[model samples]
Target: MRIRIRTKWNNQEREVSLEDTVSVLAFNSWRIGMQSLLEIENENFQTDTQMQRIAVLEEMMAFLVHLLDRIAYSSLNDSDREALVSAFAVKLADHVHDNARDFAKGDHRNNFINKLNIRLVDYSETTWANIAQEPGFSMGLTFGNHIADALGPRDKKWVLDYIQQVLMPEMVKLFKQVLARLGLINNEN
Candidate 1:
């Protein structure tokens, strides 16, 4: 079987077998449909991962709030407060440190450096003051030391202040950057 194809330029006629003609259309349609499906699946996977990350962040936030309330209203002693702050700091620091790569996102020009720079400063200022003098702090050890210093030997108010002022806000920003990098959220900057 065959069909004719006419060119508008010269009305030149050509013979095309029916199978060949239909094959191109059919293959293209199937390819396009598959591409669309793959795109949707990819989008859904990203959404699911982002949603899970958000849920974990919210849970951590809730834990902080609850801890703050306990510190505020309870009759826990100074040591207890310090311990609470230390525990939370270690956890928070670990979480942030683990996901740092996702937010740091290499040296790309579009990297989240603006927001990430502040967090890095906070991490540095909060953790290591004279790293040169020490010259021995690994990333994990530095985080541990920094978290300890950041929350050390303080009263309940200090604990509350550190969490409310420093920790939570940084976590929020870091996660926001992560989501933005993932294109899960729109970034104005």
Candidate 2:
């Protein structure tokens, strides 16, 4: 069987197809894996824990994508769409932080790096590249500035510091709330 996914990119609706044998869990796992790897390398974030979190977040992200795809294929209201997006962002953040303590010590593999590169190329061919690179490509300038900032400190200390201190905690909190609401995590009395 085939399923259609509708995503709005560049103010247009795009459709993606999924196979029947793919479980929601498997689809999500693959998408999240690809996404997390891309973010880590593109952003130049380090820390084994952060990388691991990225991998896990990839799965969660995939799950959200699956859900969104289903909704888009069907008839979903505006409120529903908004809520799903919000929930997805939150869950994504949490999945990124679930194993922080351990992540700090581990590093990503070469396989992950290669896969991420391929995925990025594929993604760039899609509308996302247009969305990300906008306002006269001002975003590219911002990214360059970030790289420059990292180059300033000895051993790129500033960059590493930001990943650990700023990005990680924020991501964790967002995902935690999302997971709670989705009933992926229990809120016991």
Candidate 3:
């Protein structure tokens, strides 16, 4: 499927095919989430086990999917938006499940989907719009809270600050560029 996006220059509109874009985004989100995980681990965040690290990665992927959904809201119709996000989530789940099977087993895909569903509910309740066009405080806080909960208690106190202050903003900025480049959203947004 293809979605149309409005551009800044001359207010012209362009199309982006969701077929290839969704797969690329799935991989990119996973890669970036892993990079973030590595950064967090290097910072002495206590993800002591592979399971905990995988959980954190799933949280990051879910957040990216939610952000992408919000960014596409203005451009795509409801059905198209649902299709894009759903497909993205499935692909992300597959990536997570496949990578996690070595240490974690028993329907990791469904587990990821379940967690994503719960997170989606929480995210939906958060204010998508604020005085600034960026993601509202509630969204970031909710995400930070999830990641903090997934990490070890020793570093839990610092995880929220790190996630909200450093990690999320960096991921948002990166995805914003990716989305714009894909014509999923305009640069100005």
Best by lDDT: 3
lDDT of 2 by residue, 1-189 (tens): 112222223433344222211232233433444443455456665424444445434433433343333333234466755555444433434434344335554333333334334433433333212221111223223222333342343435555444344433333334333333333344322
Badly placed stretches (over 4 Å) of model 2 are 1-78, 104-136, 143-189
lDDT, candidate 3, 102-165, per-residue tens: 8966899999999999999989888777333467889999999999999967877888999999
TM-score of 1: 0.24
- Candidate order by TM-score, decreasing, is 3, 2, 1
**Residue 186 lDDT, candidate 3, scale 0-100:** 76
Better of 2 and 3 by TM-score: 3
TM-score of each: 0.24, 0.29, 0.87
Lowest lDDT block of 10, candidate 3: 1-10
lDDT of 3: 0.82
Regions more than 4 Å wrong, model 1: 1-59, 62-75, 100-103, 106-189
RMSD (Å) per prediction: 25.8, 15.9, 6.1
Q: Give the poorly placed runs of model 3, Cα more than 4 Å off.
A: 1-17, 130-133
RMSD score of candidate 3 (Å): 6.1
